[model samples]
Target: MKTLKCPLCGNELTSIFRMTKTGSLKNKYGCLICGWETFELRKNENLAWKDAKEFISKFPPIMRSHQGDNLKLDFEDDVLTLIGKDTSRGKLYLQNCDGDVEIATPEDVEQWPWELEQKGGSNDI
Candidate 1:
């Protein structure tokens, strides 16, 4: 997987898991250097940029590691199309926007989008 850096700290972020929730798609994200956990969900094309920018900026870059330790990436807004990476195994790790982190295999990467809908991770907050 490609090295993903935190937009706030510019430090490498680590992928913890691909969060899946009901009514939404799976979200990719990581722990921030500080400690804050960040994640984003899928959104329509029109709301993608606006929601993305708003969502990304709302959370502070994390003043302290304890407060902000992680950032989650999303594909709903086409985040995966830009920063998502295929690990060649069976999953995909992605991070983008303000900042997020994840490591996944090729298979996971390929089906992440579909899995999102199947799992209904669109309702994540």
Candidate 2:
């Protein structure tokens, strides 16, 4: 099984179980670091897996430890392609339209995009 991650904050998601009123345990996933929680679903249920996978799929891999500025990466044809943008060659460039080009480091490549669609403004990058 693949590890689950929080879609908003990119943290490791932990599984939790709660007893429902019907006396059945429902499984849920939550991020301890960000307090992101998944909807309750019964164990051994396919929908639980589907919900977790689908929720995590919305956000791509982001630089979880970087504290610097979140560079605005460009999206291309429904894909977030950050390599060689703003007429930059050989390295990744920030697409902030500031005219002055800023080259991103290997670690910066994982930084979350500033323009990404977020829910509840939960992106703390």
Candidate 3:
């Protein structure tokens, strides 16, 4: 295992268990040094071009077709945030997950811009 700095005390982090809708999830070494625990999902490592294109049409030309393995995404800005380490069992996702905040559905999240995938609306840039 790798050692990580604690966001609380700036000391080494430790292993800990956290309860979630999908039972238990792994963390980037819980913080026992200062008791400041983080329950955020890391960026998506890979996302297929098709999946991205399905969401946004302004994707790169090479992305016109499904390429790559997966797309690393911002959980906070995810249209659906599934919280699970594996594909088996169940998949928990957040509809409108935002930076450090989110909800189970898009309607539940009260934020602007909805997401990057959506454009041409009154909230457009």
Find the candidate with the highest lDDT and give its number: 2
Give the TM-score comparing model 3 with the true structure, all chains together: 0.25
Estimated TM-score for each candidate: 0.24, 0.45, 0.25
Could you tell me which residue pairs clash in candidate 2? Answer: 63-110
**Model 2 weakest lDDT span, ten residues long:** 60-69
Q: How does each model score on lDDT?
A: 0.38, 0.52, 0.32
**What lDDT tens digits, residue by residue, belong to model 3 across residues 67-107?**
11111234343343333221232222332334342223323
Candidate 1 lowest-lDDT run of ten? 61-70
Model 2 agreement with the true structure over 61-109: per-residue lDDT tens digits: 4422122234443332121334343222324544343445456544444
Quote the positional error of residue 30 for candidate 1 in Å. 2.5
- Give the root-mean-square deviation of each candidate in angstroms: 16.9, 11.6, 18.2
Candidate 2 has an lDDT of: 0.52
Q: In model 2, what is the error at residue 23, expressed in angstroms?
A: 1.1
Output the better candidate (1/3) by lDDT.
1
Instruction: Please identify model 3 stretches exceeding 4 Å from their true place.
Output: 24-28, 41-125
Better by TM-score, candidate 3 or 1: 3
Q: Considering TM-score, where higher is better, how would the candidates rank from best to worst?
A: 2, 3, 1
